[model samples]
Target: MRRGGAETETDDPTEDYDDTHADGEAVTEGAGARRARLRRGRRDSAWTRALESRRVRIGVAAGVVVALAVALVAYFSPLLSVRTVEVEGISAITDQQVQEALRVPEGRSMLRLDTDAMAQRVSELPKARSVRVQRVFPSTVRVTVEERTPVLYFEAPDGAHLIDSDSVEFAIEPAPIGVPKLVTEHPGGYDAVTRAAVTVMAAVPPALRLEVGQIAARSVSDIRLELRDGKTVLWGGATDSERKAAVVVPLLGQPGEVFDISSPNLVTVK
Candidate 1:
């Protein structure tokens, strides 16, 4: 092949074409491999994303289940049950009476207590004017009661009937001091004269009320007040009671045996 002094090319015309063809094939294969690698990379990334999303969903569902279980345990378990009942504002009615009325069983869950129903039950007691029942956390139920006050009292065959400012006959207990005695033909709310007497008594000021020993009503229009000092007052009726109450106070100083402020506009002291 190198017969001449200057190097002469070999007579292999297909060699250059073959080398070029092989190089082209190598480049095509490399490009195809690169494309395969890219596709694999994309598939791997998509699979990873799907796996992460599925894990998050599973985690959320598990958390919800755990929370619900905890809630159920808190709601029904005896760990948060009531062990004691605390009563407040109770004087007329004994704590044992109120507790009996409540009827809440031992070991009842605080969260499961029907507070409204309990309060309603306790209020059934005549002396309990208003009641509040609540759970005092882990182990106690609290009951707050506002007892009825005796504004006036009437004697009956059995005992004294106590009346409050609302004209309700609440109890038959002995009347407390400073409470006025009510006297009427028929001493009850059903009688108009009884209502009139209580209405007039309610209008009397606290200071003047202490001096009033007895209030009698013959009819709805004829109400009389007997003071502790053996003096009498013609209170007329339920009408203009506020004016009558205001006029009767100063009229007492006038050395009168009978004070007539029944018609406050035309008052007389005799």
Candidate 2:
């Protein structure tokens, strides 16, 4: 009985070994589960960092694309893609000539057209007294030209020189409409007497311009007129040209060989 009790108090070796093994296995399983969780957390962290990096890269790339698109639009916005030309105040010069002078072709960008160069080119034309060019936004260019008008015709070595009221000689061409020829002894002399004679003739009535065929300026103080109707006018000087012209109109009404209106206060007829 004593031996049996002592044996009972002693544990079974196989059972003890089985319990220790089971406990060790449980602890090992727990440690392994914790290691697996730690490894999964590390992998998740790596994946999250990679996703963030990818997002940043995508954002930068999108920004670059947007910036490029805006830059392209801004760069090409103001370029002139179409062209329109308009000419105004041109009489002696043709519109086609003015357009050719501008040298701007169709489909050329308006921003590229050199306005100063165009104005300079148009001014090269002999008949252009003044030239002005402007760009009307988007597609139009406007050109305005002031043409020279003939005030008197003088005989030149080559032909007749057309003179304006300002005494600027333009060309030796035929007289324009409504302009009178002033035949003078000093044909090429565009001196003060010629200018004064032109001033006097301009004051004459428009109806009488073509009637007076020749105006001879022998001297500044002596101006003679040869009428187309075989009559003569002995104009004394350039004094009171308007008054002298007014007096000549009434004298022309009457038939006479010579009508002298040299003195505005006194008149003589032959």
Candidate 3:
């Protein structure tokens, strides 16, 4: 009993576990916190070093400056200059004519080329119905042209004047194939009968136009068509040209020497 004065070590398992577990958890948490601080310290030191160095800041700024300078040189210098002028969609006019109209200088920067001015210049060509001008990147300028197509032709003292759908006399050469001749007392652009005849011609389908030999108009209201054969068509005026053209084609197939479509809604064949 006298030995009780000295405290003896207990054999209980939970006591040893409780005491050691707390110490172990505390040690693990301290180590983890120290590791995280070390990582943050390393990152902050690297950032501070970079901020303190004038060369680093200058290097980034110089890189941005160099990139911008390169871009400026590429845009203004001859590196991205136009080296070729390309013309497309031409049958009556030559490429040389279009290129001359463009008049863009060689080695001119594509960015500096005025596309609208170029298109306007090309549109001055009588044969050009529509024109588009654009810069083909890196070395070329492209000119796209839509040439006027002749719907009819009229004989003049000089030559055969080709008339397009809009009554414009675009060219004065031999009439193209399948183009019907226009016969009017005054067969010029300003003539009312000629314009009526042209309107009738423009409304006729391509296949029907091929079968037609001549179109005659006395006044704006009196128009006629002479087929390749001896058949005749009495078409009315420019007002109902579209409907007359539509009715006359099917009426021609009927057994008749004359087809009258003056009133398209009431057609007659004789």
List where candidate 1 sits over 4 angstroms from the true fold.
1-59
lDDT of 3 by residue, 102-195 (tens): 8887776788888999999999999999999987788888888999998889898999999988888999999988888998878877878888
By TM-score, the better pick of 2 and 3 is 3
Model 3 clash pairs are: none
lDDT of 1: 0.86
Q: Which candidate number has the best lDDT?
A: 1
Error of 3 at 187 (Å): 2.2
lDDT of each: 0.86, 0.77, 0.84
Give the lDDT ranking, best first: 1, 3, 2
Residues 159-253, model 1: lDDT tens digits: 99999877889998789997889888789867778888878888987778999998888999998999999999999989888888788888899
Candidate 3's displacement at residue 25, Å, is 18
Question: In candidate 2, which residue ranges exceed 4 Å CA deviation?
Answer: 1-82, 105-117
- What's the best-to-worst order under TM-score? 1, 3, 2
Better of 1 and 2 by TM-score: 1
Answer with 1 or 2, whichever has the higher lDDT.
1
Residue 222 of model 1 has an lDDT of: 92
